[model samples]
Target: MSGEDARALPVEDARSIAGVPDGFGRFWTPYRMAYIHGEGKPRDASDAQCPFCAAPGKGDEDGLIVHRGRTCFVLMNLFPYNSGHLLVCPYRHVSDYTELTCEERVELGELTATAMRVERETAHPDGFNLGMNQGAIAGAGIAAHLHQHVVPRWGGDANFLPIIAQTKAIPELLEDARARLAAAWPAEGMEK
Candidate 1:
């Protein structure tokens, strides 16, 4: 969407443009998978049913499970950048990185490595942009739970949409990314 178009668009469009998770949208927080109820209490550091919580059930065919372990897992970005934008997150709900337990920290590190390796193998981008937007100030979409982002990047990935309009045009259907990654990646340590 163009900047002018973005400005003229609705708030829902803006959040969608920015990749914020709604009841039907995707967010990478290690907490609630997706909103269970739009009216239910917004979401807190304590909620665990977030999309990342359980083994994806019936309706989650498009929910890609890249790597799953007891404490951590890697998933394809339901919304993506290149081909293999992914998310690395602990299974538990954690708001602060400083509050992470030794176990969670270990899982976070290991899962991050696994996510990077798998994403690279799949996308083969020139570089990787790995980060965590801690809270609103840090541009966190899901502020309750902390998760690391693994975005694969090529030289020309940055487009004119944001340059001209301050809007991010992520043009691929999330289901497609999930299908491709889920087909290629075997979920590891998931049985536990």
Candidate 2:
């Protein structure tokens, strides 16, 4: 194109064109695209295909795992609602809380509590949301697995980016979060 043709086009501020403020910060997590597109999700609810079941077999770092209990474990949420979001899941690939064995139930509860304490010690969030999404209709991303969400919340953490652009700006990397939480986890037999 000639300079005259280029000059004829309307000029736009780069920030306006990019839909972001000049001083606003961003943490681009392109890796999350796979989850958004439903890639790597299980084809069926079989134990062989369940992520919670598979996580225990891999090393802690590779699995984004922060802590491992006897019957349940804590791992970073691949699609987090906030930074340091974690999930506590029983090893057995059960879909409902009612299905958890007594031992599993006890460990799951303990792990969830431990996750909350660890997040507080490491990140010092203002608050937390702890719950389980029982089924697909209840907003369970992996409805086949019974995992409890441990989401750290802070005042003003909900911003326009998530509302307007459907994007969350997480300041920390998954590995970094895992490392911090793992390191801050209370030692075995020690109380928080």
Candidate 3:
């Protein structure tokens, strides 16, 4: 069928035909299926099964860690809303923000701020989205771990893709973003 002719057909008719152009974009991200299926999600709330508990054990590059602090660490979000998306997590295996010690709370805040600064220096986002999901009911993917999300934003970054297709298009590779942010991270006494 001609492209114009296909467009004129009822939407259901166009999508039903094999080898026919349906006028919808395809991202072909099979990798997202792992996330959809909960491949790496912790089986339980135990520290033994937690990714946040294990990340600090690996080298910085392998772990995609941006910086390590006394009480907390910064790392790139595996499933990012945008390039340079980061999470600030404490080494302790505690759930809920209320469980954080005074020192942990202070360092988590500091690390989250530093994550924003590094993202601005590296990707130059127009602004940021920063928060912590307290529980699974509150949208925390790993409800057993306490972490704060620091998501960088640019003007017009949102579109119909996520709402319509359940997909997000990230422009930069995770490794590349981790490297850039890690390099741009300010030293302990040098943070601005």
Give the winner by TM-score.
Answer: 3
Count backbone overlaps in model 1.
Answer: 7
Summarize candidate 1's per-residue lDDT along 1-192 as a digit string, tens digits.
Answer: 665676676656755785764634322222223332332322777676555555344244545666566676677655355567778777676777887889988888877776666556666778888898887588766677677888878888898755664435555555666666556664665422
lDDT of 3 by residue, 1-192 (tens): 765666777876766555676677454466777778877777666848688888999999999899999999998889999888899999998888889999999999888888887888888999999989988889988888888999999998988888998888999999999988888888787875
Instruction: Write down the TM-score of every candidate.
Output: 0.65, 0.83, 0.87
Alpha-carbon shift of residue 168 in model 1 (angstroms): 3.1
Whole-structure CA lDDT of model 3: 0.86
Say which prediction, candidate 1 or candidate 2, comes out ahead on TM-score.
2
Q: Across residues 104-161, which tens digit of lDDT does each residue of candidate 2 receive?
A: 9988888888888888888899999998998889988888888999999999999998
Ordered by TM-score, highest first, the candidates read 3, 2, 1
Better of 2 and 3 by TM-score: 3
At residue 74, candidate 2 shows an lDDT of: 92
Candidate 2: pairs in clash: none
Error of 1 at 123 (Å): 1.7
Q: What stretches of model 1 exceed 4 Å from their correct place?
A: 1-43, 47-51, 54-62, 186-192
Off by over 4 Å in 2: 1-29
